[model samples]
Target: MRVLTSTLLVEAVTELSRGTRLVRAKEVLAWCDRNQVDCQGAGLKNQALWDADLEEAGGPHRLLKFKSGECKQSRVGWALIAHGAKAREAAAHLGWRELRWTGENWDWLGGEPPPPPRRPASREAPAQAAAVRG
Candidate 1:
């Protein structure tokens, strides 16, 4: 199985709808435990298993990114991408107060934009003197 890092998941979340994209880190771990897929087993439910600060999950690529906070969900915090809370980062950055969890199926929100800067008038023309001495 490919390692599931936040970076990769971030890209995945960008394209996938919240219904299909949201996968909590703990849920994944629990699934793995139920299936006995990894040798680490349920013991892998420790906090040190994740490293959100580095943009990579600790082991096997499972990771998460909470609201302006470090990964506390067993090192890998469970999360939903594009959800109101999760999408807040991107929405807020775009100056939008809210964003619908619609991935590719999104509509525009009335986000206020800053005004453009004004340039000062140039009183003098640019220097363009050419010498012709052949």
Candidate 2:
């Protein structure tokens, strides 16, 4: 089984987004299958793929059906707001807000925490300069 990295998936999604129409998860899955991209080793299953689609874009803007045909849609992930680390950090930094799986929408957390405090200036250099001046 070939291992597919999240980076490759991100690239595929980015490329797909450039087209006029919204790309379906199944379509992306088919592309990956044709290319022999395996998810088994990567710990990503069909469910995870579905989750990714929801996270990236709130769906039935896209869809996912199991071989069994069980499916649902909602707003998912922070993909619309930000991708990858930035998205994760945004979710983390925003205190009360959670990136929810709405099946058709991404709900941003309402409140955001203040940015981290800046460090103080170097005391050692200032002290040394004071001594030299004296």
Candidate 3:
């Protein structure tokens, strides 16, 4: 049980995507497998989760535009990864949590919480960098 984070999701999609090409659901599932994450439950659902902006959901970039008959049965339709919804006012609906599509709805994925965000390595400590700047 590993809690999925937006940062990790972004990294996965970035690594999986080619220039101007969106990552497909299958490729993302493969990534989860290679990374040892728990996402297999998602495949049992009607809609596929994508790593794109939720704002894109109602816009022209909708991933559902490509669904097959098997995918067209759900009201959930599809969901944009939580990370993609984090920057907007509408984000309140998505929240920041360890979520997974459990074939029926979004719920806790149940794993250790994500690690704290890391800072880039610096030649000087923060106080030293500030002292030098001053």
Question: Best candidate per lDDT, number?
Answer: 2
Query: How far off is residue 103 in model 2, in Å?
Result: 17
C-alpha RMSD for every candidate? 16.2, 15.7, 17.2
50-109, model 1: which lDDT tens digit per residue?
A: 322134433332323332121232222233433646544553443333222233321223
The segments of candidate 3 whose C-alpha lies over 4 angstroms from its true place after superposition are 40-134
For model 3 the TM-score comes to 0.32
Which pairs of residues collide in model 1? 4-61, 25-78
Q: Please give each candidate's TM-score.
A: 0.27, 0.34, 0.32
The best candidate in terms of TM-score: 2
For model 1, what is the alpha-carbon lDDT of residue 40? Answer: 39
Clashes of 3: 0
Q: Candidate 2 regions off by >4 Å? A: 40-134
Taking the tens digit of each residue's C-alpha lDDT, what string does model 3 give over 1-134? 54234444545566664432334446666676788655532544412234232324334432321221223341122223432333222222323223343344434333432333356988778879799999
What ranking emerges by lDDT with the best candidate at the front? 2, 3, 1
Q: Which candidate do you rate higher for TM-score, 1 or 3?
A: 3
